[model samples]
Target chain A: MAAPPPAAAATTRTGALTVGLSPYTARTSAFRRAQICRHRLPTLRCRRAQPLTAAASSSPVFHGECFVVGENIDTDQIIPAEHLTLVPSKADEYRKLGSFAFSGLPSAAYPTPFVAPGEESSRYAVIVGGPNFGCGSSREHAPVALGAAGARAVVAESYARIFFRNSVATGEVYPLELAEAGAWKECKTGDIVTVDIGKAVMINHTSGKEYKLKPIGDAGPVVEAGGIFAYARKTGMIASKASA
Target chain B: MTMTEKILARASERASLEPGENVWVDVDVLMTHDVCGPGTIGIFKKEFGEDAKVWDREKVVIIPDHYIFTSDERANRNVDILRDFCMEQKIKYFYDIKDLSDFKANPDYKGVCHVALAQEGHCRPGEVLLGTDSHTCNAGAFGQFATGIGNTDAGFVLGTGKALLKVPPTIRFVLDGEMPPYLLAKDLILQIIGEISVSGATYKSMEFVGSTIESLNMEERMTLCNMVIEAGGKNGVVPADETTFKYLEGKTSVGYEPVYSDAQARFVSDYHFDVSKLEPVVAKPHSPDNRALARECKDVKIDRVYIGSCTGGKIEDFLAAAKVFFASGKKVKVPTFLVPATQKVWMDVYGLSVPEFGGKTCSQIFEEAGCDTPASPSCGACLGGPRDTYARMNEPMVCVSTTNRNFPGRMGHKEGQIYLASPYTAAASALTGYVTDPRDFLM
Candidate 1:
């Protein structure tokens, strides 16, 4: 598949700052303050409050420090049922859900946490996770929370069907599969990594190593269009916003 | 073609379908409950316009189940959203609970959406169902293509009356031989999840066949299909047979064209199990795939026994639990909480008398065994709703529950340990205060 153009639809939808940036380009010149109004990654160190929120889309490339997690990270661990009461459709509740993302993961095991206490968004731009990453419940809030938390993408060995679909359907995160299994085992949380969706490569800058990713195939176009709704409008499969 | 392929083809108006091919299909029924309904409704209004009506009011089902009885203000308010949507659209099936103070006052109340779906006849063969909740796969027992979708997909379906779906390759499980009296469908599913691990069937369809599945009744078949999500399966189905036809007789007047897998059907893989040889089992703490036979875990003590959920809290589940409680003639060693799946099952516990027990109701037997009165249904404590949900694990106590999924913190407390067991094993464990085998009482 070819590289996606800048995500105008996504930018307007969530006001997220991810520009699908190129890792090779100099940040001072190519990377604008991206202002990242909301959902900026914890690693971006954006001090500005009330930033835009949106995830890393398939608009070619984006890189950031990773948030590492273990196997069987079910939806409960992603966004616990208690917090599921907050609807993702409403902007305020969507942000509230992000604050509580990964609240269900046992605190003893995951001491660092996905969203720090009293913090609105995560510092990590991407999630490096193990197998069965989003197992258990079919709550779409799991991915929506991560995207709302400003996490752009997830690289995992495997994913639950519903979680995978929800990620693509919401266009919240780039759910990528690792071609080199257990690649995440070598990296820890806060490891800087660059994801090139066009080339299907994930470069771990902290380790100075690069890993391969499985092509997302047919689902790629839908995600790039900012989920099924946008894709439907784009392809004329459904009526456009103006007509509706 | 596989049954799933056939169903998809029929829904999509295609002559054939392959596993990887994406196609658009008409959604027969789209069910949502309080937990996900508000979000789904919000999205529908946002995308389809505030004044836009659903594609078909009759095809949308709103059941207030997950947070129905909770006192949490937001959870309570979610139901009101569904009420307003149903009222505005004039939806055909809106199982609303108007009186939280008295469930009896609301005759339309149905506890769990999945079970209520079967009871209310929203589930039919050769049809397609997409719900906001994952357990929507529970409707696949009638040989339909039923699977769970996220609120986004459901919202889109609500507005468009169709969804883009990929046909999943089928994995056939042939369970032959007679089921032992002590064994329940819960044990069988636990065994499958154990062997296949949870992700074994990911992005695939699981089709059940053979003598053992044939011998099972409609409710038992539902139990098998309900946990397909646990295996990461898109759906699980049993071919529509007399049992399914009989169950649908009074439930729906709408005629459905039930389809069967062709003789030349191709399966991705196949598994065979002899139900007679399979022992009662449980999925222990933090994972549904962590399986251990009931007898193998007999030394592990527990603090509670909960019998409920779309997976196990049926009329038959209560009957099976009562059988053990009656046979033991002993008081429960720990707190044994009973929750029927739906209001009808609750009514059954109180109204229906067991013939083998000489006409004593399950409630009588449960009371005689020192168990808590069967609690009002509505998915109580299954996913650990608001802190006040009935029978929710408030502490880090070990529990033997008939419900599905032992994922950490699933019931309530993050440290709580859960053992997923059948009603028979759950009852016997309640008597022994450990993971006791039902054969000890059943035999």
Candidate 2:
């Protein structure tokens, strides 16, 4: 929109290596150029053109705009079984994967899009939910879809046990449990929020409020390592324990 | 220690155990179906590398039950990915769709993964079974420490044949006194869930004790354990008895030593239930724990009736429904779909190969009663299958179903309502096109 950010255009021409765009630079750059050129009017151009990719961070601190949802948000509403496809394969085409996150949520009820059209999923990194988030189905795709959609963490009053375990085991997204008192009430959509896993607290930058969250406990190291395999490899358990 | 504790201790190779202690245990059987298999295979390949082989091929079972009959290319592709992985890995327990000729045709396929896991004897007593499906806890009926895991954890188990688990505290549910004639295991479980309030047993094991539990058949016990996840339980275990051994008689060749709780074993919480007073129950729309007596919700209208899934599609479940429908002398008022949980159940219901029913099966009885019987054994409309699935709702429909979960939009359209009930209640409700208690028809 703002003249296609000269640097992004230059980088697109050179096909320079970027953090998340490294794998699909050529294809993404072409798509970006087309999207930029197609929108002759500044208002019509995409706001955030950065490929919505998971940024590899060294620390457990995550900061982003919050997307708030209500209680008992089941897995089907997160990502319906119909949209679960092998197209663009999850390994190579993450943007495609992220596009369908929360596609199952009935659009007529919540006019606010979970991942708005033409907006980069990178705009949202935190999800705020009421009680019993991820309440139905053992589908790991629920968290995977959210993670792929650029959610770094989900803060809720409670989580279904299987969903909690799946989130921790895969390290796809951090599931932070908050107390029932004012967890969901204190946060609103698009509120700037920072979740500090090390401190076990979530701070709302918009409202200047702090909420206590449950500690990750035994699952902390695994999530910090970005998944069980990475944790096992780091702790040297993969060779001994996995082989046995 | 309780039976769950003892099983976990032995699996993790520990001399002792305690609640809330994290420990790694070896898995005996691991299963993944079409809906979750592709993601699991993708994760397994990405993490363990393409050349990485599963820990044990024979111990793993891959079944394509969901999204099988649909014409959607994507759903079919999901199965293709599983088939490719199975072929590449040379896995022996992979059950594939034999015929894709017609969408409505009865394809050659094994039943639902959870039912097949038990029927095929993969879920042995005193062992651990893990699957990518939440209903994998259904195997705990055999006195095993079984639980459902997501794809990533399942991938880890696929590559390593082990999972890290925190030993959950055991909650003893003593169902005392004799069960009433009309009360099935479904009624008892619904009553338990209503009391527990869904999140009551979060991260805990539920140990079923007392005479009422012991009196239930293996299918009934499996049904009880299958829905423990509905109440946020880690697993539901029934101590192995002669009934368990008789059920497992030639199904499993693997030697197993039954595990039981010590007489003085401490439980985190103990509760007692009088099964004799239990009545037919239904979980209202939007929540499995929002339970009410079936009679209380009898005035609610319905558009369809679904009787299937690992929780309610067994042979005994079918027989129960047939008993009610055969005696009613009426065709189903609304569309009624009958799906058997497994191939054996299907055969038994149809009196095809099983002579135990004197060649007159539940399928014949239901067919005579004007119920649509799909030949394949699958989890249709249970977890809400594809658009063309036999029982899926197209609009805002209210259905009385026998599946475990009653989450909103679970069976089909987001506006659709589902009421969870037993097969008997479901059949009765289907006949009247409304929520009617099974007793009313029986009387």
C-alpha lDDT values of all predictions: 0.85, 0.78
Regions of model 1 farther than 4 Å from truth: A1-36, A39-58, A242-244
How do all models score by TM-score? 0.93, 0.88
> Candidate 2 lDDT, tens digit per residue, B4-116?
99999999999889998999999988999987888888778766778889999999999988777678777888888988999999998887874666433444467788888
Models, CA RMSD each:
5.5, 6.2
Error of 2 at A42 (Å): 18
Model 2 TM: 0.88
List, in the given order, the native-contact fraction of each candidate. 0.68, 0.50
Q: Write the per-residue lDDT of candidate 1 for residues B1-443, one digit (tens) a residue.
A: 99999999999999998997999999999999988999899878867889999999989999998987788988888888889989999999999898888787889998899999999999999999999888899999999899999988999899989998988999999999999899988889999999999998999999999999999998999999999889999999999999999999999987899999999999999999988889999999989999998999999999999999999999999999999999988999999999999999999999998888789999999999999988888898988889999999989999999998888899999999999999999999999999999989889
Model 2 RMSD in angstroms = 6.2
Which model scores highest in DockQ?
Answer: 1
Question: Candidate 2 regions off by >4 Å?
Answer: A1-58, A85-89, A92-94, A106-109, A117-122, A239-244, B102-108, B352-359
In terms of lDDT, the poorest run of 10 residues in model 2 chain A is A39-48
